[model samples]
Target: MSRLKEAQKSSKGAAAYSRYINRPLGRPMAATAYALRMTPTQVTIVSAVFTLTGVALIALLPPTVWSSILIAVLLVLGYALDSADGQLARLTGTGSLAGEWLDHFFDSIKLATIHLAVLVCWFRFFDLPDGWLLVPLVFAASANVFFFGIIAADFLRRVHRLEHPHGPAEAPREAWRSGGLYSLAVIPTDYGFLCLVFALLWWQPVFVGIYTALAVINVLMLLLAALRWYRSIRGLAADV
Candidate 1:
């Protein structure tokens, strides 16, 4: 198969929105990155730069629609680049443990940083309830635990050469393809969609409603995911 085609295949994600949308958006950039002979780590770094720049701008800029929109655009670009790096890695046959670590590290940073950035925007601008201000912080902290648990569980399974925990009995389903209801549960946690959420920040009610809803949903989902992964790991160990 051609490199581009292979890269295209590699772009698919477990989330339907990602497979259908984000991956497609990133394909052209993946081709570009390939042409430029960019390394996966370099692509990862560039992705972070774009994403963090957007987050920083959101925190620093005056609370205006224009600033919010620009931040949204930057974040969308960052998400595309994020998708591109893995595709680039697959295309170049440069997938490495170190490269994987770097990719995951960047992902974790944004997991926390994005929420913190939003909190900054709120604290600096909005007159939200003091208790409400803690939601983002809660999300930031809980999300890390979720991520760490998931990754650690996967690592243990890999090291143990255990069977894929959720096989034919519980086939993997893309969050988007699942249903609108399921998608809503999963989508808000997505950084790609979170970019769009920033645009709603200037509108207080819309922003707060979304922020609180997403935070609660995402935290619950993450905790459940972590629990599922932990159970899988424990089951594997028991079988041993």
Candidate 2:
């Protein structure tokens, strides 16, 4: 009887770990927003507005390095809002497919605007030589690729969860701990962090290098997600 009890405890721990690892970081904010009577759509619109303001400040302001820093700060706020919208919806039981799709659509637009703002800043203020715009352009494309890739991967993960109601046993407890750490790591590695780093290192071409590397990784992540999604659907079809 003791052994059976121990085994059950272990199983429970493992399931808990898996859930912690797979969870996103926006739940708290979502809860707060829901308590405050904000809707997901409202949060989404507010996030976009903040992001647009950041881009405009960066592009149209006087040629000062401080402006870049301010823009970076605003960009971070924009990202936080972006996270809060979905969270609020989930917490408030107001989540819908249309809201999710619109969130993604606006996310892409926000990314594009950020890149364009950076390019305009460099071109207008820094006065780079001809063809220098290509640098920001490349970085921008990479940023978009990363954003879209992450979204795709998340969608595939959700679909898999839905289809596999009871596939295999849950993961080990250690796996969940590791996954939580990985999610935290995303805070430093995300686009907002990249932008802040670029602002600080604008004097060098390191920003360009960082952007390129991030873009490449984004593309790879997207491809892996697409493959996983395809496999999940195929497996479901086979069962049917």
Candidate 3:
């Protein structure tokens, strides 16, 4: 099997887009990193460089033929590096709590930064309605809040011996989330999909429509997940 196929075996689980697209695309790089004996944290720092570079371009540079294409490439590189870091960790058995925290912090900043960049982009150039700039801010909060909720649940679960702090939150086996057609569904929260939207900035109408739709989906999902988590862990909630 290819390195990607090997990496997939180690994937605990992921949303469809990550399972199908990002992982597969990142296998070769993961293999290369392993061959080079690179540490997971090193890969993460490199990934941050690529991600922040892409964000800088999208956030600061005006639309140009070359800028969009270059931004797309950088974002894709960042994503591949992101995938490789985890795989490298798993492959080398260097996956630590500290490393995981580092990775999540990087993702959190990148996530917030991208949305704010897009907000600026829209305000400066797009033909958007008044106050439409606030849409991205809402999406940013929704996504981050949902992420923090998951972390809180996982931490509380660990405290109560519900699961190990470092073990699988679900089952050991792959399921429907690993399916190929999941790309379409995962677009709602896929980092790559969001980058694609930025890359298509020349088409302001399409970007605005997609950005707003994604923002709404994120808010609804955040509420639904938070409610479900609260209900499921009501015992812990009461004790706290």
Maximum-TM-score candidate: 1
Which should have the higher TM-score, number 1 or number 2? 1
1-240, model 2: which lDDT tens digit per residue?
222122211222122212242123344555566667888998888888877887788778854467667776677667767766755665556789999898989878877877787788777766557577776686677667666666765675567668777765333334543454554534433555554554653443565566556655655655664675566556555653
Distance (Å) between predicted and true CA of 48, model 3?
0.7
- Model 1 C-alpha lDDT per residue in residues 1-240, reported as the tens digit of each score: 257566565322244456567777877888898888888888889999998898898789877888888888888888888888888888888889998898898888888788888788788888877788898898788778877886897788686664655532433535454565554446766667767788877787898888788788888878778777777777766765
- Sort by lDDT, top down from the best: 1, 3, 2
Show pairs that collide, candidate 3.
Answer: none
- Say which prediction, candidate 2 or candidate 3, comes out ahead on lDDT: 3
Task: Go through the candidates in order and give each one's C-alpha lDDT.
Answer: 0.77, 0.61, 0.76
Residue ranges of candidate 2 with Cα displaced over 4 Å: 1-32, 152-189, 198-240
lDDT of 3 by residue, 198-225 (tens): 6776667776888899899888867877
Question: Which candidate model has the greater lDDT, 1 or 2?
Answer: 1
Clashes of 1: 0
Q: List the residue pairs that clash in candidate 2.
A: none
